[model samples]
Target: MKRSVVVRLLAAGATAATAAAIGLTLQVPQAAAAVGGVTGYATQNGGTTGGAGGQTVQASTGTAIHAALCNRASSSTPIIIQVSGTINHGNTAKVSGSSCNTADGVIELKEISNVTILGVGSGAIFDQVGIHIRDSSNIIIQNVTVRNVKKSGSPTSNGGDAIGMESTVRRVWVDHVTLEASGGESEGYDGLFDMKNDVEYVTLSYSILRNSGRGGLIGSSETDTGSGYITFHHNLYTNIDSRTPLLRGGIAHIYNNHYVSLNESGINSRAGARAKVENNYFKNSKDVLGTFYTDAAGYWQASGNILDNVTWSSPGSDTNPAGPSMPSNTTVSIPYSYSLDAASCVPNVVAATAGANKGLQVSNGSCTPVSPTAGPSASPTRTAGPSPSASPTRSPSTSPTASPNPPSGTNLSLASGAGADGSSKADGTSYGNVRDGSLSTYWSPSGATGDISVKWGSNVTVARAVIREPSGTSGSIGSWQLINYDTGAVLKSGSGAGTITFTATSLKKITFRITSSSGAPKVAEFETYAS
Candidate 1:
């Protein structure tokens, strides 16, 4: 048979399955089958085309999945692994090779790239087993169910995370899957989906995460602030106590999701994290959006959301809720393109499209579920702007002194008074080099554009900054933004590197973000002064 004819047949089968799942009366052309694609932030960073144009394999056990990976030609080889049946601890074991890394009692996608795990047939269930992804990129996981994974009990796996990514992971799309736990930490279960330690450019779409103490988290802790650029859309979070999720630091665009029966809190953006929340439905939940359980606050930009029967707790020393009335405190700029379904129809849209064995139905961005082959409806792209109810407040600034040179003051970055972190560092470069006061020792991001920060343990007042390139390596830095990390506020933005003067404002951390660059930029010194 011709390849074109086969492709059409497969697409028709997918359409039929989708129609059946949604109870639509559509003419069937072929038998139903599973299909795959990427969306949201996963479509960025060179695009996550998992296993496209590669070989396809089938697996019914965890060991078989590892065998398929280990049998690949290279670590970067693209392969689609169609999974079915129950994958438990007994059927999972270590299967190691140069192209793959595996461990007993878990499905590990480690130190590899360009892979897809799609559930097929009746279903794919990882019962008491977990999927662990580390040091990998360009991956897709769709139409599967992972449940009852435990951290400190018999048959423990993946530290109790149904699906966890960490340690330099990038560009992962998890769609149309179900991740659930029996109970909370006391019940031996942990986060449903968790990302930490430099993970970036990820999306969780058309999925369900429920019945756990912790839904998930972006960064692991208060100081683990490197991860960012995540999108959570069209997912369902229910019966989770808190941390749905506790974002430590990063930028997350969350829209069109449904939250129900949140026992404690929902969407705990904290430790300098910024969340752009729009068009989501929160029903019978508590403290749906806020910085909670810590003194280190986070910021949010919210709009077009519906809160039904939701309640908020009173403010405390460590808890701040964005409720009783949802207001925008900061503006987050989303780089990618997306369509938002109306909040009024989110519950129905999510219910029909999310979870496994649902034939990969997706919202048309107009409150209707459609076959994946039909594609998402065209809608106006939205960047999180100021809400109509509130505008972002800026800190009081002091006028800069008239000086072509940097203002006469000590460089706050020096004298061991500050620390450094960033999105990613190139091989053989150090984040600390940017603040070490040495022209020869410099820092470069893994790519042309990234973020670097100079943070202090306590708040300090500064008004002037001088971003210096390595000697003889000028003009590498292009357009950039100076952001107050404490409040997710853009203080100064311009092109090139030179003397940058802003109002003297007290802040704990300041970031120099490179949006675009001509080449691999090198920062010899990031000097700050108080005038």
Candidate 2:
């Protein structure tokens, strides 16, 4: 296992859980009162005006509202505003309030904290970003719906991020915030939430981003200040198209997030940002990431992130490069070079509570280490004798041989196995199969029957034994398929119990699927055969 992976799993998971629990229990605390009678942030009060269906506030203009709200502080005094009717900028969702660009639209903040922004009435339609924070700390933005901020005409030259956060902002919490249609070239911007500058101890949870051109939310660091100690969990990144910007910036923790990118990378961390991309589901991404810079000063860390069943929108070939391409200057080997073992990921309470030091622990979970085992080896214990049944019977084995160069057919076989030491460690609840022996596991879904693991050795197609489930259990040993993990090709498939045998040059790992009828089913003692 790698140190980067272990540290990432702990820090990112804990921070996100803490923020969620805290945010739910203790609503965002109000900012402390302004000190020394300083100027506070302000928002434009567009006076009531008659419209076609209802009366609208003149200040309801995103620019006007932003001008009135930016940089204004509500210290010991909570400055609150109530508005009525729709605030329209453009029709597109990505347009920001800054696009209105009346000099008055820009609100500025300095030396102020303990601020609150709440929406009352139906809340005016937000043509621009509802609120923008800059050079401020101890800030809370909650219970606000920032919607319909498309540019009506053209966009402001530089435009604004729906929630543009810059400068050094610390201990800031944003919750129950809905940012809709806030990104794209039309708005001359990117991302529903863009936060740069020096930011730390910040948490964004329970937030929803929809109909955006780029990332549901985006984070980066100022040129000098490094962006670390940030948590983005429990947030839904949905319906992002080609317009979405990359989801990440500098070093941060991103997990437990359901990211769906119709067109673009699900989550990208560029500019040498170290991140832990874990437990996230991405749909239609060219690659999990474009690149992971592993240079001395820059690089993003990846681990435990499930790349399960992602369908690529466009497949690129060697000659034409229109779709996702393989990573450059990277090695593609049988065993993942820095892969983390399955058992090590879970928690270990004994080690966790005993030391009480800073480390990763899955509160009520424990990680039981499962060592890797190799195939059968040659030894002189048993002498080779023939003519028992006239023709020699195939031997049950694990070791496999490589195929000739440019071999055809799907690749298959076991990659690693239990450790040779055959030792077991039972410090907690979970158990690890430490013993080095012939044991097997199988998956059988309803309406499906058989599955097999095949390997080729010495030009012999060896079919391993079948360890079917106990009899009279209404279990079916058919309807299973063997799939090669790397090339996404089917080696051999069959229905009903029996044996499936195939010969291939080399083997790594194979998957047996039961078509997922109702739920996933498990069987004991799947056979492992070799020739």
Candidate 3:
């Protein structure tokens, strides 16, 4: 048999051939089993043809294998041919082969279903995509690594996603596959993952997202309700070097993950949407673990999460001196509400003393036993208890100027010599320090007996009385006791005034109206001192 005989049979559409040269016969199985219309073709063959010495003749080749698979008679079965080597598209027709070659493109699945493309590690590298699934279903792309997919559209507009899901793609499962570098536009904005508009009922779990610019993972919602039943868990966000998004969204369940060395935030819920942040560990949350927005209007419920290095305004500075101010980046409006949950629920106080937190227990429309959260280290700093028997000092400085001026632009006159009508004046001595129509009046020790009082007339009752001692004198004083000279009941007896060492109890209006006395006593200031 001549070598030309074998080549002639291959060109004549024979499956396989046999050549006998120098009495040596070689037989070849020309047809490889084709499952459907699909057939196999390779650019190079390793001399599978057989015969002896000058009897050596090239037998039937792969060219005959291509014609058999391309011209299938049955429509029910498509040929499945494996390409051991690449076949160029330009030379495909002249060589009797399928166009599963050349870098231009390979394996185009057009409007077909139930196709599986398996790769042997590095064999899936394509000049274009290794596999393009368009308008198809029941498609499985398993155990393949597609490196560097090319782009068809503009990166700024509709370039491409690592895996593009159009308007109506359902029940698609992309598992255990690596979509390496493979740059395109539209979504995937330099990330390992990206999805947009109507990506409903989708899940990405147990995956590693790293070294992408748009972040580890990114997604957005077209409608206010947001898109997808998104679940992000058990993934490590490492070196996520993007302007934002270590993982971002509102309708997402973010839990059990570690976020390390992020630039802007560990996780950001855009200033517009409400989100639930729970049970996640954050190590260095530089400025904040998370920031909720008020301008865009959303609620944030933070529960059971470990936040280290989160910063808020200081309690000692004026700008944010009393902690974070209400109504920040987001606006919240409520109708006179309160909370019962103790973990982070506390009432906002008003009309209390400057440095005190109004009490939480309110009874009979009054605030009682007001207490603030513990200072410095969750423990209240010790305050000296009140001494029941001592008269108290009103002036924090305890300075006694013969004429202490009231704060400017007010009528706190202290020059009249008679105590107001109901004051407790001395029996025989004319003290002459009482002022009938003044706001703040003080009396010094005119005699050693040391008895004095203020008389506020019947028309108006004395609202409060604050007494102070002369500076540098540590003497003790008797309390300011009220007396009704007509009935002599001594309505309220002296308990003793605050001494040089004690401060007094603050008082509201103390009324004194006697039937026996004709007119009301008039007093503007309180008077008391030691013997």
Candidate 4:
């Protein structure tokens, strides 16, 4: 379909990966190896051990991304592209029939293999544009946000899905992303993320789907059952109307996902689709898991799911309750060799690590123990073959630095020493972001009870300690403490992320210990001004 879109060439420089020091990402250690056989989004399709390789370059804008993909299409050399800046498509149209075609505005990874696309810097947002991946393998997309793409009001392809894949796709992993919309197709929005037509072995983890009527789906139609073997774990689905996802005739392992604020139905599995729904947290939703509106029907084996404050729909002829029990139908065994965090801890883990730019701090969070279980088939279902690609980069987290000079004679406390009692997500940037100075960055302790403390080189006069969330952040600090490490005294304590004013005193160190929080408290800056 030809349409009016800005499918242009790119500029010179993009951004770097979020790993240490930026511009480089290494393979995950054995101890840190994740579920889906690979680590980081880059290896989603396939990792360095698979196919993607070559120099890692940064790109910004849809044009730059397209240029990078186009440049690498010939050699088939593995590549990692770190994208920065906001790529605004602005009602652009699709220009090619191939799913991976570069139609200018929307970034398409068509006919590519072993590639990792990461967002860098403050963020990389694809505003009003969708990402299409087709005939590709071993692809990873992380720390990116795609929103506001309208299917009806403007020019788009495949219904303006925030991220869509189809045709001979395999081993694609998407993590720590944010996909949102203001309305459904009637309001010009489609699926947050969708897959179809022979897609398999895909995973979505530690990401978010919000403010849309549709979340995602696999196997576009009942006959398109070739798309299966999908995995979803540790994601947040909120403010969405339906499709907690619509699975059709595929085997999906869905676990540890948080569902909230749904007005319509959720998880409509039908057309012979089967899911093993485990350890999920749901609140204020209706029929969170059941058969689709169609009659073909679906089945699930649910275990360890918390449906707190959720309302169940009446059991109609084709409806089935998805919560609080496991299905009596065929039980799907977990093919992965992995561990699980406790159901109560799912919300905490997801809140701390899901979405872009908070440091991909994946917390173990008090999980129950389990043994390695094999798949139904004796042999391995999938092993990223054909030599692994280069390891993708993780975002480099910068710790807080002491202000060079405090305004009006105040000595900004340089954290000569810093430590956290415990943290949920710890990919470098942890308690130190409080001193990092940039409001765009902040420190979020896993769960709510831990303390992030900063120590000075020597004793200094201190009067006030100020703490606040990043700009446009609504995370609330219910109650917190300002402690003097020298004397082990609580100089001040208060609720909310506002400034904590206390009498100026001499102290060597101060700590910000949070007692309670509404959402994960994001401390952008924890400043202590000298007396």
Q: Name the top TM-score candidate.
A: 1
Q: Could you tell me how far off, in angstroms, the CA of residue 503 lies in candidate 4 after the best superposition?
A: 77
Better of 2 and 4 by TM-score: 4
Better of 3 and 4 by lDDT: 4
Q: Estimate each model's TM-score.
A: 0.69, 0.40, 0.32, 0.60
Position 373, candidate 3: lDDT = 32
lDDT for model 4: 0.65
**Candidate 2 lDDT (Cα, whole model)?**
0.36
lDDT of 2 by residue, 148-180 (tens): 343333443113455656665544555445666
Q: Name the regions of candidate 3 deviating beyond 4 angstroms.
A: 1-160, 164-166, 172-189, 216-226, 242-250, 271-279, 283-531
- Model 2: residue 54 alpha-carbon error in angstroms: 33
Ranking by TM-score: 1, 4, 2, 3
What TM value does model 4 have?
0.60
Question: What's the number of clashes in each of the models?
Answer: 1, 55, 41, 36
lDDT by residue (tens digit), candidate 1, 1-531: 224323432443534343223221211122223343466667655456666655676777887788668766566666788788899988887766667899999999998877888898999999999999998877889899999999987879999999999997877889999999999999899999999998888989999999999999999889999898888999999999998778988899899999999999999999999999999999998999999989999999999999999999999999899998879999887655566788999999999998888889987767888887765533333433335334334334322222335558799988467988765567688989988878888888766766788999899998888888876787788877787765545677777777788778899888888877998988878888886
lDDT of 3 by residue, 136-214 (tens): 3223332233334334432221122234432322223332234444322332444444544433233332233343333
lDDT of 3 at 158: 17
lDDT score for residue 425 of model 4: 28
lDDT against the true structure, each candidate? 0.81, 0.36, 0.29, 0.65
Any runs in candidate 1 off by more than 4 Å, and if so which? 1-37, 377-531
